[model samples]
Target: MTAARTEQAPGTRAPDAPENDVVLRLEDLVVEFPAGGGQTVHAVSGISLEVRRGETLGLVGESGCGKSTTGRAIMQLPRPTGGAVVFEGRDITKLSAAELRETRPKLQMIFQDPISSLNPRRRIPDIVGDPLVVWGRRDERAKVVPEVLTAVGLDPEQVADRRPHQFSGGQCQRVSIARALVLEPEVLICDEPVSALDVSVQAQILNLLEDMKARYGLTLVFIAHDLGVVRNISDRVAVMYLGKICELGETEELFDDPVHPYTRLLVSSIPSMETVTGADIEKADRGRGEMPSPVNPPSGCRFRTRCPLATERCAAEVPEMREVRPGRFAACHYPMLEPVGAGAAVEGA
Candidate 1:
């Protein structure tokens, strides 16, 4: 995170954000799929966010919270069911197939399963350079491929001729990064890029991403369930619940003083330095009900069933995101951090 970071409250300009600097924006994005028997899986619902140039925006949430779906929606992978995906001042969702293909080079994604993302039969150079060939830069593939491969710390001489299975998980991820960078993209959506690796390897991949971001002058949308990992890498963090954003703020601020009930639970559940034994999953599970299925998410506030602060109003009306403090926003009728004139009604108060 940058020392001079600006807080990013939705619908308001940060002091540091100049007009035309936002690299990507999602407006009222929605994604849904039929679950058979007249049911619908609400993967993402009415979520809006933006990523500024050269900034890393972290999307944090537990499994099935739609963070990964949000990232894929940004790529227009399935063409979002509603709303727009604005990239570089254009709504990519409206682009024709040819236009979208042309725009893809500027927006790339790194999937969670690195080894599976690569082809088991293809050599490294062919895999990394395939984008060039597909995008009509086949002539430059020979020169550009090795440069990015070397940039990602893989020796072309050694790994370029080998297949993905030969490399360890971390090395395979490096290859994935190299492939994403081959197009010199401005935005990289990393969906849990380190979740499958060893703890030590996770650090290496995170550092590698930081290096790659700086080297390419890239903006990143980093999606992961690990709060600790997001804290270490993201400039700003958006905490998601069910299918919507519950809180958004600068990294340290959100972690140090979480305002949303869900955010508080997530931050507290992270293993502290004193608790090397790791988070007490059983204990944490006992404190909250099972996350509702997206096919039938709770009305009004999806987290009300588990929130200690939930009220009748929380169940009756949806909470719109509002500024809880300077540059921090939370979508809760009864936020953990109450306003100055409001009563303090949080748990353990």
Candidate 2:
């Protein structure tokens, strides 16, 4: 179900965000598609978020939870069904096709399957330099393409003539990254860029991304199901469930003290040697059921079906995103670490 928005939401900027520093803001973003038979796949429900300049905002959630959809929506991949995507203070969602082409250079993306994303029929240089050619900057191809290739740790001299199939998966990802950086984008959206790589290669790619971020002054929207990876790179984290954000806060703050039951379950799911909290275990256990179909999502809170603390109010009224602490926000009528009052948990729930 789509959660209701409060005054704090749609206007809920990241805690560390300064009014003038937000590079991208999503206002009630929604993306849906026909599922046939008069049903619709609620890919991304009404959700609002802000990406601050020079900060990595990690979007973490389980598979099919809309993290990747949200990332693609920011790029206007299919043009969201609703809402505005404001980039650099202008609503690009309203921009004309030609206008969008002019604005696209400042925003780039690295896909999950690096090898598949790169065209096998094209040579490395052609693949990486294609952006320059497309944007009418072909004159700068020889200069900028090699520069980005070197920046991403690939020797243009060696790999430039080779095809995408010649390099390993990790190398192809580096190529994808180089292609994204070739245009010198101000914002980079990484859609699970490392999920298809080896554990060892994941670290290398992660390190490279951080290095690139610092060297190029790029804002990032890192979408992944791996909380460990998100914790290492993100300044702030937004936990999504179904199609909405359940919690958002500083990386460490949210990881250490998750407020939403869904967030707690995600943390508990991570393999840990340290003791897990009783509350976290309980939340995780309660959240064991299969996720409800997005086409016919549960009423009120989307997570209520699996949330053990759900009550009648949870079924009747949509939870609004609200600050449960100084800076942390959660969209649950009965947030964790708070006293359960009138919306107390239902018996045997």
Candidate 3:
């Protein structure tokens, strides 16, 4: 059975509740890829979450933790194997190809790879205006293309006729963002938008996205592996591990007071020059191990293999996400009451 959805604020709707303030809701969403020898890669396993309109919901996790897959699943790039993706009160997973194509304009995604997402042969104007052309707005391309290019901090006059290959990585990303914005999409899924850029360029792209969000009245799903970046832009953050969300809450709350062992470890692992000494490094190394293969993940809690708090119980049954604080939810039998460094209980204690 799917987990029960949690309630939101007065004006907002719960995942299972009637659609109101919520723009996107994932109900027991599952995505799996088939491997050879009849094996399956469990990409996303029963992740149910809600994204309210006008809010930036951050999805963070280590590589191979299904963050990107979750983002793709939301767009139905490849329809999920199980569960539902409800967008604006409609079940998109159930929509036919023709029906889904009609609904695609409102939901758009900015891919992780800046250079490859765009066609090298296509000129900037033609690339960014492709969406308009598809939607029978070729006549309006002259106006819309330039407007969006400028909105993304690119000079329309200079870049309009240029090919994507001529621009830098940062410039290409700006073009990609411009393409996504040309449609004035309501929900924008940014899949590691800044991961491939230099540290200096990352800030520029992030600031530009914030500005675009306000200008377009967008609701964003920002996916990244960097906790610092996620915390900076996300109103609420979801920490994913092995296809499931282990902890979720307000960004500040999750950063300052992480409840799950995995969440705590991730927060502590953030690089800091002042805190990179012997003791800090030692603490960071604790319970560290390679991520288990998704093809044959651990039995109960997928994170138990690397969790210091693992026990027979943790291996016996899967933990359901429950409210640990007012708006914070964690899927752990023994959620951390204090920071992980403050003598939190662990296995074999």
* Cand. 1 Cα-lDDT: 0.84
Query: Between candidates 1 and 3, which one is better according to TM-score?
Result: 3
Considering only N, C-alpha and C atoms within 3 Å, which residue pairs clash in candidate 2?
none
Ordered from best to worst TM-score, the candidate numbers read 2, 3, 1
Residue pairs in clash, model 1: none
Q: TM-score per candidate, in order?
A: 0.91, 0.93, 0.92
Better of 2 and 3 by lDDT: 2
Candidate whose TM-score is highest: 2
Off by over 4 Å in 2: 1-11, 338-349
The residue pairs in collision within model 3 are none
Best by lDDT: 2
Q: Sort the predicted structures by lDDT, highest score first.
A: 2, 3, 1
lDDT of 2 by residue, 14-47 (tens): 5656767988888889999998899999988999
Q: Per-residue lDDT for 1-349 in model 3, tens only? A: 1133333222122334345777898888899999999999999999888898999999999999999999999999889999888888788998899999999999999999999999999999999999999999999999989888888888889985799889989999999999999988999999999999999999999999999999999999999999889989999999999999998888998888787888878877888674422332244358798999999989889888887677888899988888777778888887776544555643234
Each model's lDDT comes to 0.84, 0.86, 0.85
Worst 10 residues of 3 by lDDT: 4-13
Better of 1 and 2 by TM-score: 2
